[model samples]
Target: MDGVTVIDHPLVQHKLTIMRKKETSTAGFRRLLREISMLLCYEVTRDLELTMETIETPLVEMQAPIVEGKKLVFASILRAGNGLLEGMLELVPSARVSHIGVYRDHETLQPVEYYFKAPEDIAERLIIIVDPMLATGNSSIAAVDKLKERGAHNIRFLCLLAAPEGIKNFQSVHPDVKIYTASIDSHLNELGYIVPGLGDAGDRMYGTK
Candidate 1:
């Protein structure tokens, strides 16, 4: 994929395998998601611009590098995205947060937006949209649509799993935004679920059907 980056870190891959197992408990699934998300966050922000700042060393004064520009904005796509958001926050506690409430309509597989909130200076920050699964891509695309309407231009999308169909669909709509994921599964099933993917992430994490 031209605009996609697959996080193949060994720890991430190992944890994802356990999360995919049907017998894994909800607690286990949620724990692994949080743990893996930090690793994903590491790669996603690897290229962040940096600026040198004056700092005091044990023996002398020196210039140290720090992240440049405004703090990042992690735009979570409702409930499931919060799983990834939790760990990313642990890694980047200073970053800002944004919540975008969008869900896939079971019948139409379209996105329905219910809530949205973000920092007033969102347009000046790098927004990273978090979601567990990019199965049909409707919800992610819609969330981006909403963010762009608010003047967000520097944006990235992060997810635990993605389907080829979903990637194609998302790229078609937002080619400028890059995507980061733990894995790209085979395909989407008829019900808009990623094939060979960990089951509905929200259901697994929350112990719901």
Candidate 2:
């Protein structure tokens, strides 16, 4: 719980409520996803390092503090994460992007990584991994594993919602990495879906079902 930050902002909660409705339209869902992500990004990046520099305003020169170092890497955890990535990019236009794809096997309840690509110098920049739901957390853990293999150390995991089990699992695996979520649900269902969750994030986002 120490490293996990839950964003309870009213705008975020309102958008999440819209997203959770079973009758919400595809267009509405998509738009809300972007809006909620932007809201969450505001909190996620609140502590970014700042460096002071002299800048010329319209009337005079003044010292200002701007975000330091190379822009952060917004790493999407595959297809669903893409939704959150779009909004985060709107907030941090200069941030680099990356992707990691993982699918769950129903029978085995295991995560299968199908794709991964990241910036060559991930270690030199902050990395924020975005995914809408953290249910069982297998895919998230696996995604971070791949990132670590590529030398990414300063990493954060951001999601729209999470289950307590998923949070504990992620923390146990990567205690150093902070987590940010819009909400934390009660538990995961028998099928490994978060109870009362917005349902399959990829399916809902793409209108696949």
Top-lDDT candidate index = 1
Misplaced by over 4 Å in model 1 are none
The local lDDT score (0 to 100) that residue 205 gets in candidate 1 is 95
All candidates: TM-score: 0.99, 0.98
User: Cα lDDT for residue 46, model 2?
Assistant: 94
Residue-wise C-alpha lDDT for candidate 2, range 1-209, written one tens digit per residue: 68789999999999999999999988889999999999999999999999999999999999999998998999998899999999999998999999998888877767999999999999999999999999888999999999999999999999999999999999999999999999999999889999899999888989998
Which residue pairs show collisions in model 1?
Answer: none
Q: How much is the lDDT of residue 60 in candidate 2?
A: 98
* Tens-digit per-residue lDDT, 141-206, candidate 1: 999999999999999999999999999999999999999999999999999999999889999999
RMSD (CA, Å), candidate 2 to true, equals 0.8
- The worst-scoring run of ten residues by lDDT in candidate 2 lies at 101-110
